[model samples]
Target: MEVDGSKGNMAESPTNSQQTVSDDDEIDYSVKPEFYDPKLDDKDELWVQKRRKGYTSDAVLSCPACFTTLCLECQRHEKYVTQYRAIFVINCKIDSDQVLKQNGPKLIKGKSRREASSVGGETLKKVSCSACSTEVGVVDEDEVYHFFNALPSES
Candidate 1:
């Protein structure tokens, strides 16, 4: 059998003359929202109060990089294992296939302190903006929930 060099075999390595481009050298491709739009109606008075107090619903966790609606904020709970640590659990209804199509190869695996140590020791998959490659949130192995770094539309 013949091996193709272009297929990136183990023996294939780019030389300095190949002109490799680092991620930093690439142009900024982060997606920015032209306008903020809350797709869902804010009818719940408790939600309004929470939003005013800086807690937002799932609609607010839109990605700043691609303006993708990442996850919906469900509720805030105290981390029982960690003192003074509060976690906002988020729910995502989008299909995993759709998420992969939008986020692309930016989804990576890493450890998060927010997740319970009992559940795989905080190791989870994180999704980033496909365009700008900015980390937006994390998804569990089941893709039921995501934890984001910023509020929706804040980016």
Candidate 2:
């Protein structure tokens, strides 16, 4: 509160009452504070003991284009390959995730691509993002979805 310049009356100033957020002031809402365990990074024997009790490792998979969480699973083998820009789950025997259910994989009728890097399948089904209909992954015969291609461009 401040005295009015002309009327001498107590009034609140705009600068004191309102706050403007700048472009630099961005907050990442993806990580939940409660679920964050700072001790996970500790490379000591105590950390191993703590994890042995009731520790669970979870990996959150999100769409590359829209950043919408596609899968939330504890499958320790699953990972997103940065070089290939794809997600690979060891063997997708588990049921589909909520995001994948909503935007299920659309099969490419009468077509399949020969994958050179996959250790499991010779050909995989190409899938698109529901939020984007853009090709983002390939699925194998075992129901494993390998997200994005890690193939480097020739040019």
Candidate 3:
């Protein structure tokens, strides 16, 4: 068996230089494109209306505990790494039944995006729970729509 000059048995071992070389060969995920355009624009009309009307939907849902109004908007994720969980559940309250009746609930549906600026065209309010800082709901011109109770808390 071969041994080092110090008489200790020496076995072939990976060096820091070899590890560095292997790491350099690894794929660079940061250079990959992350966003893809939505395949369909089925809600185009509703979306336009919501933006033009400033989310003036008349849909209303009240909190049984506080009687406070609520509404919702989808917020995109902050990082580009994982966009699947990008859409955030936002809340506020508004009052505009005429808009809701005219456009329908389908317009309220949100699509995830890669940009935070593009999230919530106009319907999404910036209201938060005055009590817990939790986003309670959002409102349009006529009423408020509360968030889904089953949704996990946004940390």
Candidate 4:
């Protein structure tokens, strides 16, 4: 019987180049570092409102009537007029299920855009607390509702 040494040896031995290629193909499924921002702690309502006059993106807002926590602090964003504009508007993205619809005339006549532009008409519908029927926020044309009558959950 002829001994088949070559086949067995090749299977057992991995060349340096092959080993490096295998190592390079390894994938890391770990979560991203930026997913959790350390700076969010400093952007809460207490800090932003005291200095800037309103909530920041890191403020936990809740329904004022029932005190139900509708949205977390991380869901908020500051709308500014310009890079150095004096006007600042803080808006929070609240879920639709958390609010009750109120009867009001349509605020905008056009579709909502993902990003605000000069062409798109800004629409806003009045919304209230689902649990207490208290006026809470306005549903924008983007379908993202804001907590206009919300207070800090911690307060």
Among the numbered candidates, top lDDT falls to 4
RMSD of 2: 12.7
In the range 1-155, model 4's lDDT, one tens digit per residue, is: 34458665434455676568554367555756657777787776456457544544445566676776555433543562111111222333334343232235333332333322344455455566566667666665566655556765333
Which of 3 and 4 is ahead in TM-score? 4
**Predicted structure 1, TM vs. truth:** 0.30
Ten-residue stretch with the least lDDT total in model 1: 80-89
The CA lDDT of each predicted structure is: 0.44, 0.44, 0.37, 0.49
The residue-by-residue lDDT of candidate 2 on 17-133, one tens digit each, is 367776557666675777777776665445534533453323445556565544333233335434232233322222222122112334323321222223232444555556555
Top TM-score prediction, candidate number: 4
Q: Model 4 compared with the native: what TM-score?
A: 0.34
Candidates 2 and 3 compared by TM-score, better number: 2
Measured with C-alpha atoms, the lDDT of residue 43 in candidate 3 is 69
lDDT score, candidate 2, position 87: 38
What lDDT is obtained when candidate 4 is compared to the true structure?
Answer: 0.49
Instruction: Kindly list the per-residue Cα lDDT of model 3 for residues 1-155, writing each as its tens digit.
Output: 35677768686677777668565578586775467446436566465456435543223333334544332233323453222121222233222221221133333433322232244344443334443445443444333333432132221
With candidate 4 superimposed using the best TM-score fit, by how many Å does residue 4's alpha carbon deviate from the native? 99
For all candidates, the clash counts are 5, 2, 23, 1
RMSD of each: 18.5, 12.7, 18.0, 15.1
